[model samples]
Target: MIETLAKLVSTKIKTGVTQKELGARINMKQPQIAKIERMHTLPSFSTLTRYAAALDLSIKMTVESIIK
Candidate 1:
């Protein structure tokens, strides 16, 4: 799931924005964005949300009860 999200962010960034630009939008550093794009480190949920928002994307999570 995380890799998927990271890939999405990376793809959007490739559309013209640089990692540094994204970092500025999210108040992060270019290296941090690079790490995320490369999946070298896992980003926190809030960080992922911020990343998505900066790219004009949205994230939705659903939890369902498990019954045996």
Candidate 2:
């Protein structure tokens, strides 16, 4: 889930939004979000929920697929 979210984050970055701004939208600390995207850390379920919401994706179903 973090990996897919990171891909979207890369898209957001290319579109000119900073990590700080992206983190703000998802209510995460910038460094926390950064670590997840860099694959240095895994995000919690709630955090992934927030990220999925922020990224306009289906959290439950999609992640079940990912986990499987």
Candidate 3:
């Protein structure tokens, strides 16, 4: 789950917005975002919810998609 989300947040998708931008939007610190993106920080329940909202994805859908 963590890895997939990180992959989705690669530099390629960092054009219109970067990790720092998204982190600010979600009220998470840049380091927190980086750690999450690097699979170093496991997201909390609320963090996951916020991430889904920010990425415009349903938590269930996002999680299910990463079930591999």
Q: Per-residue CA lDDT of candidate 3, range 1-68, in tens? A: 75547545753275466778788879988899889877797877678768767767545543356566
lDDT tens digits, residue span 1-68, model 2: 75667666766777777778879998778898889778788777777777666756645543345564
> Which candidate's lDDT is highest?
1
Write out the backbone clash pairs for model 2: none
Highest TM-score scorer: 1
**Candidate 1 lDDT by residue in tens digits, 1-68:** 66657566766757788889889999999999889778898888898889888888777888888985
Which sections of candidate 3 miss by over 4 Å? 3-15, 61-68
Off-target runs (Cα >4 Å) in candidate 2 are 62-68
lDDT of 1 at 24: 97
Cα lDDT for residue 49, candidate 3: 68
